[model samples]
Target: MSRTTKLATIASASAAAALALAVTATPALAWTAGNFTATLNGTMTIDAGVSASCTSSTLKGTIASDGTLSITSATVDGCGVTVTPKALPWSGKLDNGVATINGFAMDAIGCTYGGNLTGGFTGTDLPVTATFANQTVNRTSGLFCPASATITAKYDFAAS
Candidate 1:
């Protein structure tokens, strides 16, 4: 074969091998799109002084293959204090063992609080556990509202 033709053939083969390697090196997602429900494992703390041992809380959302969490609705029930989620749809992400909820706004106890919540998440199988310890939320309104609040809660998520 001609020297130029042999070089062209080698280049084509190297390019094909690199493409294959890239495709194989891509990582698989930990979670997928599905109907998921999260339950509070323990008490949910609001701010610094108020602690709400809510009986039940509901989280409705779907996780995309790209780790994006699209929360359609959420409810915190049985806290005696009315807890209302401000934004209809909340956006979050789960990646590298960390879970983050962006723009999480809520109204409770005649006060408004909104911020991002970031915490660790575990479990590759079913019933993933997300623990948010001392996640800070800033008071958006209400004179009596605490300037900052630390929230600690553990939530278990499972496909429903």
Candidate 2:
């Protein structure tokens, strides 16, 4: 082969290798920093001896650039009982395909429960589903409250 032809082939091979390295070295951008909203996919049930099913619930929050989730407000309605979120801002982390919420506390009919919740995230992009199944919470107060309770719910999150 001609010397000029050999030089061109070598340069082309080097450029292809560099491109491949750049693609592999780039970090995955799983989540972005922006306002987000979470809506209940169905009924949210809390079982602590006495089962209560809430028809609807909404959560509003913001995700930082570093994938830190900050829930600013959350509201649950229906089931003939009022469910109130105690903590003003609950923090968590969204990484890989998992979602975790730390220090989640709620009150209902004088009873309060608090614990950490872990769930999985489904979806590649904007709208993702967060399903928390049988997350256990211990009673923080109230004589009538059970020692422990389980909460199950699926929430769909989207950018607002």
| Candidates' C-alpha lDDT | 0.80, 0.88
- Against the hidden reference, what TM-scores do the models get? 0.78, 0.84
**Best-performing candidate as measured by TM-score:** 2
lDDT value for model 2: 0.88
> Over the stretch 24-142, how does candidate 2's per-residue lDDT look in tens digits?
89677667689999999999999888899999999899987666889999999986788899976999877777888888999988899999999998775558889999999999988
Clashes of each: 0, 0
Q: Identify the runs in model 2 with alpha carbons over 4 angstroms from their true place.
A: 1-19, 24-26
Model 1, 23-99: lDDT tens digits are: 98967766656777788887777664767766767777887766678788788878778889887688887787888
Any residue pairs clashing in model 2, and if so which? Answer: none
